[model samples]
Target: MASPLRRHAKLWIPLAFIAAAAVAVWFVAVPAESDGDPDYRDPTLPVAERVADLLDRMTIEEKAGQMTQVAVDAVQGDAVAERGIGSLLNGGSDALHDTPEDWAAMIDGRQEQALDTRLGIPLIYGLDAVHGNASLPGATIFPHNIGLGAAGDPDLTERAAQITAAETRVAGVHWTFSPCLCVVRDSRWGRTYESFGEDPELVSQMATAVTGYQGEDLSADTSVLATAKHYVGDGGTAYGTSETEDYLLDQGVAELSEAELRRLHLAPFEAAVDAGVGSVMVSYSSNDLGDGPIKAHADSYLITDVLKGELGFDGIVLSDWQGVDQISLDYAESVRTAINAGIDMVMVPFEYERFIDTLLDEVEAGHIGTDRIDDAVDRILTKKFELGLFEDPYADTGNADLVGSPEHRAVAREAAAASQVLLQNDGDLLPLTGEESLYIAGSGADALGRQLGGWSGAWQGTVEGVGEGTTVLEGIQEAAPGADVEFSEDASAPVVDRDVGIVVVAEDPYAEGVGDAGAGDHDMRLSGVDAAAVDTVCGAMDCAVIVLSGRPIEIGADRLDAIDALVAAWLPGSEGTGVADPLFGVTPYTGTLPVTWPARVSDEPVNVGDPDYDPLFAYGSGIQT
Candidate 1:
């Protein structure tokens, strides 16, 4: 219809415009090799290859920085990006006011700075989140490991860890120092509740938490690194041998033969390794295997030859808080020995700058080899790569809503209910029909902090109660709304002739070496205030005593004979309703005693298999109602 040249020009012009737009979209969408991106930045490559590429380009200063972990309060502005801090942690009480979103914002800001560094490598953040994302106030707080050990349900342990991982990731945290696999041999070690039980088999069974935290893949959005903590023999530390002042057993020595160590203590860690745990934290306590006691941080034979070589744990080996300093008074020697002992990361919580400079100097001198530094950096970076930090380092702000959700609390309630161990129920006193006139007495009746014990909101949980939690009294009232419910803190009120009196006694919250009992007035006996309340309530009416404590406390033989019912409510945490569920027949009493209930304060180290194993209640004893 038209001239040949004009018609052909018209078709070619439209086609050329279309081709130009398509080319522009392709360049913007796809990351071509010619875009000058490094192999480490490529998401398509294997994580090992990416780690290798990244490690090859890092400087010695950067490598040392990769092995240094600083506490959150110690970090100054721009220090994270400038010094290339490999990790950051929220040590208890450091940043206690941070909400879930606040934590996410802070972590994301730090991650942004880390990404702005020369290599643009992202940093990882960690927390003590031993029981749920407990550092955050509103996050779900599950029962302590002792309760879980009593529950004896691996599936429940796994579910608790899974929820912990999700909430932690939502807050932009990458790692949790959790699933304390210490098979506690001594109940007076202060961290007794952190252990699963006295038996290696029970502790090993709880190792399913590893699978829960990491999930099937590390790169998943909900996954966070899980640590099998205080590696080898923390719980077996001998009483009165502690280096920490006033601590009777914590940070003491585990004096035992190598065979006994393996048989009693090493089995849980071995199981953790088999579960593919991404990290192992060395204990602050020392181990005596036919030789003088040596700090685990300086024990090359155990960490390197045993944990790495024999156990085949390729994950990063981390030092506990100021753990290396305990090895030697000489800082340089301490650094040298700890590094030589195979500690991949140093938790130089406060003195990060000193640690970084000292580490670099050690590498410059012949004290610590560059190859070892490289190895440490490699292990650290491998985890960062596996965490998918390079591709998506920012927190999923949308997931912040998952913290303390109703669904999570439901699971925690279930775990708490399952963990209730009914020690005595004379004349079928328990499974109360929710129709009794209940008279609740004692400090633990309405105190959430006492029920949570240590590591609830702060390192050593507060007496004023740290986070949101329903108290046992409130749960009792909720369970029986139509019944007459009265609460008295000290039972100083006039005696009421109720159908039943519920007396709640508690051990005040303590963490680490501070909670140690068995030395001078710190014995495991019930506190005077709680005992007085117990006497007043049990004397006036038919009573059921609920002992809310971290470990077994001495309730004298007279008290045991007097009470109609006794329940071991070991740190039920935020979900106090679970404690009521079993009592009101909502759930059955399935939990057994994780540790033996001692007959007296003299039975300090009593356990399942002692030659003189006389206990008030044997290990695994629970009265089914």
Candidate 2:
């Protein structure tokens, strides 16, 4: 029983050891990092070499532990260190977060626990950060992916991602679950805004966000690992097939032919891999390969064969939250299936204790192989080495002040302005010149929560405890200083006499399964207060209906005729000024429809190229001037 150092001390290359020590001393001056473990600590060696050295030293327990990720609240005291946990994730809108300093402190506290382990291996912290670090207050809330798709400028998408990376790193987070590569085939899916568009080509183009996230080198302090999510065919799930009670289709069953899956759903992932994305998240949905409904979590052929073998994705493959649990009837079997299926890391979230025990039991029973564990941990460790997380494990708080800086918001505004699609301009009523008074009406007119959509400060995004940002009403006032712009929640205000009326309406914000349209039972239309407000405003004055929604709503032919102009402002986010820019002619309307605008809710899953295509507004349709 000799110490590993004493045993391998004779094998250590003296020159390489000296170079590693030099690297440790050199990198420590800027951001404090690892100074121990000669072979792993040495920055001069190839990442592969460093990873191999570290792997040989880990015990079976530690190796198994490296693949588990749990929520921040799941661990207490020194338990995380005791168990040798490898990663921590702060879920959307965690109440513990108050300020950047507090966030950084939490990360440091966990990291300290992680460092106290036998090998002092550091943990990688992650967040949703899908749109400009949504979990943090004062962080820039960029337009959702559907809007970015409408803008169709990969350069802008990359720039926004770069800013997201910098801001996220400042908050001490090193990984972002973003650039949701789901190519939406159905607009009824609640997460439509999360996708670039219905077209695979469009989704592939926007994978530029991967470049923005990883930058040229992940070793840089500013870069964060980007994730291409819901692998294979999350976006192609057939309507009405969802089993998550009351839900329909989202994360349900995808029955796409292998060719269609590769051509459409899998195309964007290829672009992401080309950009060197550090991770891929397996989809919660099931894909039927002629046998029966098989969850992606248990699909060895897809995860290990298609993604890892065929696509050549060398990065880590992560599981969605609680995804493994749904794989089989028993937790231990589920754990075994998901692991052997090629998921490198399991986002166990709240049940890490159970997950850890299950995995250990599976390994001990020979249900799961040590070779598989080694492979998974190797990929995980390789990324950590590449991220330079071992070199600098602590949060970089220097750019904390840049969370919602003017420069980042400026880019958000530009993105918002470019995403607006003017569907109709019957009387050229838009571009209000400030020469005439205007009236603002509808639910979303002043709702910052609605404009930002889902996954903003919380998972099921809401107005309650929202971050600081401009509402559409505020943007209107700012855009036309000389003109009289008044807002009435229900258009019941005294001054009904106005040159023009702007009615804004939205679907209450939603995220994933909870936002589904159960067999089209969920009406994608402006109803109740929203519809009444639309009528009141259009009745009082020549009106332009500014639709702030994730996808096309059922504003039937009657409603369309009532308004003089129509603009599809798909969840423009915090910068209401971006919407105002196009509405007031500050910037011309350049956005085209990313998905086909349906004429009714019954045309639920309609998109471009459907036979007998009769959309209210076709994909790529937009009015100029």
Candidate 3:
């Protein structure tokens, strides 16, 4: 009934009010300034002045405390306050107690003590949330790096990092050691599956994108801090040279020339630095330049002279666990060398008192300059400030419910679906929708403990009661609700006259160099036990074989020809159920081979850059429905 002009005026008034209200809410929720000037300007303020302003309020002991990171096992809430410890880490050997609430409570208690320190500096918590929020009980676990490489979508990799950040925050963790940028050149290395691929371009693309997952601006977010790790040439190490008593372990020497090193090992790190990665962890392997292992904690040429000066990286440089000790047998000497080398933090997970005492002695003797100590402290403090720890000093236990929540699990399922490579499905045995009963065989089929793979409940992974984990047997039951799943340790176990037979074969559960050592000199052939088992199973029933291993193994042509389908499910973590998504028709398989699949051990260690390049399955090759 009103005139057109009057009607327009009435509509515009409410819309203007709504917009004004929205702006007001944002400003109120996120305050512009707390205790200081909103637009603080101090061009003349050296990094030390800015650091000293914060440190002046801190007690001497509290200042000393900021230099160390203790393992979670060694902590008690009151001890953190008493010693003024600056950081805590859940090493690969540690695990969260059953519930997310329990995990959060543990972190919250430590934070409370850190806040109670004289200066009230917040404590930084770190963990190896390498593939997902892996340490917590119910946290969603993604496929290892190899699977991620096959997807070849940087945007998706970034999204995965975002999801990892969100879920990790919910579990009371504020940092993740992830996005391993190592360009793996040999399949014989134990941690090959942890790398994205053999090419520097692919590794760089995936690793750089992950920096976005933790948020481009760390100053105002609760998202986890990301670390680009095992810096420089860990993946190019020669076979049988790792430091482990076992010949095949992880800490080995890389054999590349200096030029080859820059082309392959250095590119990903350059990209990571450009992406504003918060930290870098040094590798344990020695470089080919005769520098011994680049002992990140004491290599001035690599850490200070190159990374900081040449590359222009400004983030904190942390030592891998126990790496500082490699500098000198005398604890005090080790402390001096590592600090002089420009390491901002020492992850002396144990023996902290010794390190602290030795460092104090070095400072008094003038072996390590106070200025150098102050420089390292400033770097550490600047990072903590940038992370907004001063404003919010405690973990939010209420958010613990988000760990392993349905949303996170869904992401893992999506990753697994995307990562499953259909190497050979000759008779269309996969997507087995109509099979009445699925006869499942092999040690891994019923082994929940082994299915989770390394770094789950232990450093090298465990075989017995390795905490609560899911098995592929359970995954199959969930996938094909009506089909019967039979399990067998001995591959020749009597079949129940099933319509389809599935044999899940695995290398006896081992991690890193231990797994590599067992495969000795062979051209990727299946072990005698595994081969005998596969033959026994196939001879007993009509079946398909699914390999659950760290890398591809060559099976005899006669043995491979007997199978109707073959799938490479490389250590698909707690969400084994996700693997079945491809086996069933729920999701199409799209993953390609991230590493070359050699036909035999004699044809070992070939990478994409090699001239001949003959392989059982070429890099980037996959099958899709």
lDDT of each residue in 1-625, candidate 1, tens digit only: 8889887986898899999999988656442333478889888998889888888777777888899899987999899988999999889533355687788888888889889887888889998888888788877888999999999999999999999999888888999998899989888778999998999999999999999999998878789999998988998998764354645487789999999999988899999999999999999999999989889999999999999999999999999999999998889889999999999999999999989988888878899988888889899999998998888898886877788889999999999888899999988999898888888888788998888888878888888777677888888776667668888888887777788888999888888867888444446778888899889888888889998988998899888788999999999989888899898988899999988888876677888888977889999999876
- Which stretches of candidate 1 lie above 4 Å from their native place? 1-35, 93-95, 241-247, 518-522
Specify the poorest-scoring 10-residue window by lDDT in model 3. 34-43
Candidate 1 local distance difference test against the native: 0.87
TM-score of each: 0.93, 0.92, 0.85
* Local accuracy by lDDT, each model: 0.87, 0.86, 0.73
Q: How much does candidate 2 score in TM-score? A: 0.92
Candidates, ranked, lDDT:
1, 2, 3
The best candidate by lDDT is 1
Better of 1 and 3 by TM-score: 1
Expressed as tens digits, the lDDT of each residue in 436-512 for candidate 3 is: 67677776777755566666656666655254445777877887787877677666667657777778876545555
lDDT of 2 by residue, 421-515 (tens): 99998878877786688888888988999999888888878854278899888988888788787888787886466889888888788878666
Model 1: lDDT of residue 40:
90
Query: How many angstroms is residue 345 displaced in model 3 relative to the true structure, after the best TM-score fit?
Result: 0.3
